[model samples]
Target chain A: MNTIALLPHQQSPAVELDYTTFQTLLRARMKQAPDREFLVFPETDRRFTYREFYEISVSAVDWVGRQVEQGGTVCIIFRNTPEFLAIFFGAVALGITVVPVNPDLAVPEIRFIVENSGSHSVFFDPDMKGKLVPLEAELPEVRFSPLADVSELPKVDVPAIEAQLPHVEMTTPAAIIYTSGTTGFPKGVILSHMNFLVDGKGIAEWFQLNADTRSLCILPLFHNNGLVVSLASALHAGGAIIMIDPKASLRSFWALVERYNATFTSVMPSILAAILALGSDGRPGYLKGIISGGQYLPPSLGKRFESRFGVPIFEGFGSTEATSYSCFQAYPAERRAPGSVGRVMPISEMKVVDENDMEVPDGTEGEICIRGANVAIGYHNLPELQALRFRNGWYHCGDYGSRSREGDYYFSSRKDDLIVKGGEKIYPAEIENVLCMYPEVTECATIGIDDAILGQEICAFARLKEQTLVTESELLAFCAQSLARFKQPKRIVIINHLGDMPELPKGPTKKILYRVLRDYYERRLANSQDPEGLKWVLGSQGGG
Target chain B: MTIPELYAALSPLAEQVLRIPQFDKTLTMMSTPSWDSLRHVQLLSAIEQKFGIEISGDDAFKLTSAEKLVQYLHRQTEGKPQA
Candidate 1:
């Protein structure tokens, strides 16, 4: 196994990790607390103790062993469920990398991931048979199996599979997580067992998580946030996880937390906004803190949620390439700086660099770079992208940010998201943060539209609260108070005005898709005679 | 309204909003992938619009299955004039 070479300054008082591979970790947990509740699937009302899950993993080994060899890759398509966890744990323990595809993606998108990752087989939910069965003929080399329950797997004696288990190493690839790329085909991020474990341990230590910590997982397991932050971190801390289907969990979010006595949960900012809009009122119960990331968390939304629910939100910063999160707001919520993503964790080193890759002084806007044991090996099958992103011995996170003199980091925007209007660079968050502060505005996103004179003109989309009416002119007038002339949006599209889009276009995790909004503009409003008054134009297009 | 009557009235709306071929008592968010959170909200909104009744946020999430939704609707429209 290749070890990460850490600089002297990067070293810290490390948390001791006794197990090298996932198999040993599960074995250790089973021996330590055989009957303790480890995994809970609230939707199906199923619970698995440590011993029960270990036995299920053994069965998974037997079933998967028949179809796939060690070092082979298999694609799994399932919502958050016990079967997904069982297969994931079993496959990783056997040194077979697992590729988890979002079951909601269209067939062509799913086929692209399966073929690109070179998965030997695809295990999916029986509910998805209608969507996936057709792909079987399209890709004859891949095996497709639909599983309704983990019990459907052929059972094997626990000791028999245990004796024949392969010698898995820490550097063995565990999962190839596909990022929802904004352009072109999505790239698969290859992460090793060490990558997951180290980042998981870092999160656990940073939050002071322990066996008493019960994480409510509302994020999809297909994403890195759900896998590394929720599942892997809880596993590293020997804590219990309450898993719920991300699609069906929003309405029941508070109820589930109270019912399960969940102390910690990770979610995107949109979840908080939805909860607030639903007007769900109740005590936070035993919930200690909420981890918000995977997208920018508007300061107004964060402050409102905290004031209303009395639960602190610990927003962090990271990408799929770096496991989950490399930094988070300080613990206890009160110690966190208001608008910052917080200090870099002890397990990783973070710095802001210029175009030449030289480290920049504090308070300078530049690309943020991370180097740590938790960083992924590289992107799968894209060597050019791998070399470009992973150059200089540091993974160049294509995000623009600045480090404060006090050591807190502030994320500005994506490197591509920088809007150069008349040569004045503007980050979308600056305008979005101001727009979201409006009383009726539930959520909003800002993007740059093509302009003849300025190269790129500012455009914004805002989703108003249900049953609320606010004119485009009124919102523009509101922006004029906070923003200068150039920074203000040239056109603001109220998503509610567009009859087809009840909410802003969002990914599966509910992050607003700015790219889709740009395309919408290019198609509908670019050459319109009246760009600001979109009501007639959208009406003509059958959208209003 | 009776349980069967409630189910009969809700069948078309559930089918329309969830975009499923059919709706049955066995259907649930866990069992039917089409009954996702977004569709769950739309289904509740359609029911509200059809019956002219407001479903509180507190009660909205608990109605995950067709059985639960039918029972909830029955309780909500027990003596009211159905739209």
Candidate 2:
């Protein structure tokens, strides 16, 4: 039997293992279960076994070896495609750092990410022909390669760059993932291989993942949730992953699930709402569980989905700065606590603290801070932000929340999103959560609108369900019934759709675009008489 | 008929209504502020009604600037084939 060293506190009685690197993890899985299916995507009619995927990935590694020098940064500007996975891992294999850029970013945003990352080479999808034209002239040193042309890249028998590669200690920087700066310029969160390894191993151990485990990839791989929790975790756990096309909306997701018999999936609350809107009959039969992140999962929707599908919608939370999942509700409806995001993992530790970094008592709201092996080293080229967020050996997550006496963490609100209305502290998420319970409300965002009398008033931008219509007053009444008067939105703006729904950008660790929505509505409110009038104006103007 | 010409022809109120910044003459309307499929539909329909010229769907998708819109108008008025 092959000797497997044991990691500290590893409870795997069957196989004592210490997988230090992603490459080692992949190779071990291939040796142990070469014939097992490694990846499945029925929507694209693509499935690869462990042997097949390993071979291709190795070949891709060899291919990239000839193309890039050591320590070169390769920018990836493709949607969530299988090719993206191959390219990402392929670059990693060659000791090259990969910067996955969101393909849906607007021109200016795209330019900022690419330029700020200081990447000299990029691999792009052919579909983005016109989008990059504006910035192409400015990037004189940047070389662009189309994915469509990669097949035609001449195969040279170049020696493996492995020998030339430096010893990549787990603590060495692997990649710099950019946070979606909805409020300011995007920051590069410098994550090392150790950060990723700890997160993947920690989450896998916590969730009991193994070679037989399969996770459906619906979230954006550019973001940490899809990359770390879904892809990296599968790699470390010796499991299979199915890539979902970013363009394939929730409308056709269940069919794809049935085709692949997907065991697990992950998505944000908006995506969950979209799936729920598809009806219970629309749910696929093969799903074992889904880890919902990127946004808070409303208990009502979570209950509706779990009761209807018989598959638990497990709520998980983490930030890009901390890799993927820091905390999650495991299995069994009995162990699950309502409205709680669950306890921290074994490899991770958490403390709810005030602005002074002192721990708050249980049941009191405070900034939820995290300390673990999974936390990133620091942000690249951002000393100020690095010092601010990473201090005293802990990641000061800007999220405000409280912990129950039982150690269950409950999310309250973002410290930045707190509204002081007439000296009353109100969280928009609390109001938005109440509004989401209403059947007519497909999605809602709360923002503090300018009010000369009250200094600031709560205004809600709501997208109603299809063919389901309710007056603004009725929606407000629903909020009034469930929440305190101060928490109730002073005004509601009803619309057909909040966004494209799928291509919505998520924060580093899959948080919703609340800051983006707030800015958008604030701009809208600046020019309009009222929230209702802004809705009418926006609808009439045909600008989403 | 360039984007600049269109911006020049329109009053400042119309420019503000469009919500686009700077009228670059060489740019296409599709790249402009109010140029999404829905907004394009409304803008084109209004333009057609105002100018009394029908824009084919194919040509409409291809029209990136006000200059292209003017060319399409000239072609329609000059009895040229719509294609």
Candidate 3:
């Protein structure tokens, strides 16, 4: 185990949060401002004040207590709904770990998480009956309960349930978030209550959040960005949050922000791209800034969005391992660097280290590592992976980046995402960033393909702007102007050329799945027939 | 087009766009795992193309269930020439 320490400058009241567990925080918020609106779900037009949310959570405590014990784990599968949070808060308050699974995942994937987490019961939304009903028989040991609405939870005595709630320590595991692994099954990241509280406090402090801070949650609650950055941060600050179903909220993003007076919202880069693609004109209203992370935010895209919408995007860098974000761009727009993710937050320490875990000099690219109370307890049920990743008192982030002399961190690429061609290393972001500068390119991704001689070749996939026509050859020429000859793509695939994939293959959060693109290149473009009319501009047949 | 007629016309498109085994009245954004936000947009776009009409963003998200979609389309195509 690694010793956790606060940074030297942890002086902000937000950073010096005294509450230990989530329950304590929630109780404090309720006591401070019981009448203040805490969570608002626009899809169902549901609003819950702090007191109401606490009451519902108490109901959930009683409801889940009947099924699972204090030390057991429960899986909650629901879209961004209050029911999900209620169950989550209930389970964690009772010292039971809650595993929140994305309901959109295939049944097999869902089963893998439930079984791997060894969850005793799964409290799923009634809407997922078609999927979970069949799993009950398959996993006979696990109890499957459908919770359609918070109203369905038996109205239990709030005081009695609160009194009987187990004494949960700050170190008690709160949730096991399973990140989509690059290779086989996804690994479960065990986040304790202290991790959530510390990370949430860090975000709250970094953003300078207060009771007036209204967060419009456009991301799914299952992810750390939504959980900590949006929900937990707001809770820590006694702020209000308007939660909407991520899928259903894209078109209404501006409207919701304006209606709720949302001062802050967290989203992925793809969401920003999607909103930009909408081409609808709207004011930013009270929206102070957009928090972007979970993937690389192309500097061009970030600049374009900020210029167009007049809202600064505070792009950060972190993984599920460090809760949501460990570092973020400086607040108060004028202080931000143009292309950096920003300096490390005061709650954590971030250092770029080489393969041997030695600190690299400034302006040198190396793997990014984080150490702080915010770092997770480690992966669940995977001791070997835990040992490998969380070693030497630092959580190896597996992302390659460098810190500038000014202390600004620039994320280069994922360690695995690096493309080495002809004995020279290249980050896909290098080429993708250049491609995005083109007028018609809305979003793009670059990946390394298997090359017989060079070990890997470059392939770029681009999604064009709406109703825009740019041939692959033209894009290739455009890329040739900006990128080096060695780094230029050998092939460019217009992803939406034939309308087969109207959008790039993405995960639930809309992060572009480069592995899926690699597999597509291997199976469809390289191996078999090109039925989808993937417009591949092969620039120079062999190595670039 | 009546609701049932609209439903009949939408069944195949929903199945294709959503990639579901079948489409039923009970199928909704909540009930159907495959009918995600992206597919919802696709389904709406396909409906717009097939019926030669446009669905505004405001009305699009409200049409979650198959029943709601058929009703919404019936109103959209009513008193208008359908493609």
Candidate 4:
């Protein structure tokens, strides 16, 4: 199987940063470094040089300009392919707002993002095109283009800007990335160009990113963790980026490293652990460093990866609302300390604050409050939720953590209903909402279980609309197709029949009882594992 | 103790367990889909248990093929010739 032999020849990293507008920067880099390879997909043996990428992207920009309004929102539904980046920067060049959607999102989740954002046009890959086609009848007047059509369309000349506005300032809204909240509905986090650019600069500075930093992007582009950190960091440093399939990432990872001469990248703990588990031949090239975020990397796993690979796995703490990274463990020595998320970045001010917005002492866990240029411009159209999360000048991340005497921060848990299973956070409402889309599912509830590994796992309970027999594996597979891997439920509890239902709590104002379902699952888990009861409760279709 | 002999020995099992034919016949760890980052640990554990040989951390991280694993095991076994 010696797959490494299947990849293209490896090349040294060549950083040639050109600043200005993204289009101008890209064009200049291409002209200056015409022969240097920029992006590569090892599995497909697809490689693009700076000159080639710029030429194709310019044509894409011209094509998109004709299809979309100037400064209008252009919806994008695609995985982390070369075309995804091409289209993303293409839209940005025309001064159009880019709205990214997770191609793996369920039907309801995808519909919400499209409707709420009021996108004038959408660009979807083949995988996501079928899903959106069914919803086209529901919403008229919105233009759609398959990503396959972009390359085949007669390459258009770079169109002139009809009405030039001042360069998209640091304040200009760059993207609207949808993230789920405790309430179940996903909220569009408005991050400006400044937010991502500032964070990219901070991360690049922290890692000492230079032209010699070739990076591997195995993370999903829709998430801030992948887009802003891995891809943007490489681009900002004038380094080359290599994209790989998430499903086959581990198998192709080392070949990508040898093929690209990669020096750095960001990954989730799960991915890192998977790489480490591959034993010896799976060992990648000698990278300068690797950054882990999106979830906590257990100290044991981090130590094993560093000790074995001879390179460190530096942990970072951040959120979509915080533009990817707020704090980072910059060096290997810093990573030795268990549970530390490193000190706050220089561009940001972090505080461990009490419920009353008062700063708490060192070693005492409290709400992690961040004040920085990297903070998002609040949630779109959720004034009340935004007001609750923001206090004074700091954006209170609904996550509990503590700052050490040395200024390092350690995560405790979420203050909301977010379940970070593996590396991705699964909002119960998001899963429950998706489950309702199934024809057989009448009502559903989602919860988390304490796993020996993976920290937590998604567990779902469903009451069928009729007497339908559905297996747990079917539901799990359904979730895998509809949602991202981390958001997929690890187990499904099927309720055969719905008897006289228990009285759910009433929200003084009129709201669905999301809590009632949660409590039921929580009780089931508590009772099943109760020490007081001598009986070992094996599974017989119970929640949790 | 050499890589070729190791490949000869483990080739059948690697094929059967991984369901990937022509695996250990001429493949590295990176060649098989079942030998992914997560599955690699389980595979190594199975190998270590089957051979009753303690795989060093460096050797464990570096062994990409049955041949490599066998070479490392032979060296390890040679280092303690008395047994």
Q: Which candidate is the best by DockQ?
A: 1
Higher-scoring candidate on TM-score, 3 or 4: 3
Model 4 per-residue lDDT tens digits across residues A1-544: 1211111110111112235346655666677677787887664467888877887787777677679866788788776677778888778777677888876565656777888887878888755555677677766777878875345644655444313423555455778888777777878888766567667767877887766678888777887877778776676676788776554455356666665677887788867655654443535575777888877677887888878767777888888888898898756454445678887887677889988889999999999988776788778889998888765777888889999998889998788667776566778987776677887877677777655345566778777756588876777767655564457776677765324343333478855455665676666654453331101111111111
How well is each residue in A175-217 modelled by candidate 2, as lDDT tens digits?
7787634234567877766678778887788777877778888
What share of the reference contacts survives in each candidate? 0.18, 0.00, 0.23, 0.01
Question: Ten-residue segment with the worst summed lDDT in candidate 4 chain B?
Answer: B29-38
lDDT per residue (tens digit) for residues A1-544 in model 3:
1233432222121334488888889988999999999998876778999999999998988888889999999999998888899999888889999998877665666888999999979999887887677788899989998888899888988888888988887778999998745443578999988889989988999999999999998787887788998999999999999988876776667777777899999987767765665565658999999998776666777787788889999989888898879999999888999889988988888899998999999999999998887888888988888788888878898999999999999998776776655333466777877788899999988888765324467888899987787899899988765454556787898887644667778999998887888887787677533322111111111111
**What lDDT, from 0 to 1, does candidate 2 have?**
0.65
Higher-DockQ candidate of 1 and 2:
1
Candidate 2, superposed: residue stretches over 4 Å from native: A1-17, A149-166, A418-544, B1-83
Measured with C-alpha atoms, the lDDT of residue A229 in candidate 1 is 87
Of the pair 2 and 4, which is ahead by lDDT?
Answer: 4
Clashing residue pairs in candidate 2 (N, C-alpha, C atoms within 3 angstroms) = A294-A510, B1-B67, B28-B64, B29-B64, B29-B65
- Chain A superposition TM-score, candidate 3: 0.78
Q: What value does DockQ give for candidate 4?
A: 0.04
lDDT of 1 by residue, B1-83 (tens): 78888888888888987767788887766556556654665677678778888766446656878888888888888887654
DockQ score for model 3: 0.25
RMSD of 4: 11.6
TM-score, predicted candidate 2 vs. hidden true structure: 0.66
Q: Which stretches of model 4 miss by more than 4 angstroms?
A: A1-21, A24-34, A153-166, A332-336, A434-445, A451-455, A461-488, A494-544, B1-83
Quote the positional error of residue A430 for candidate 3 in Å. 26
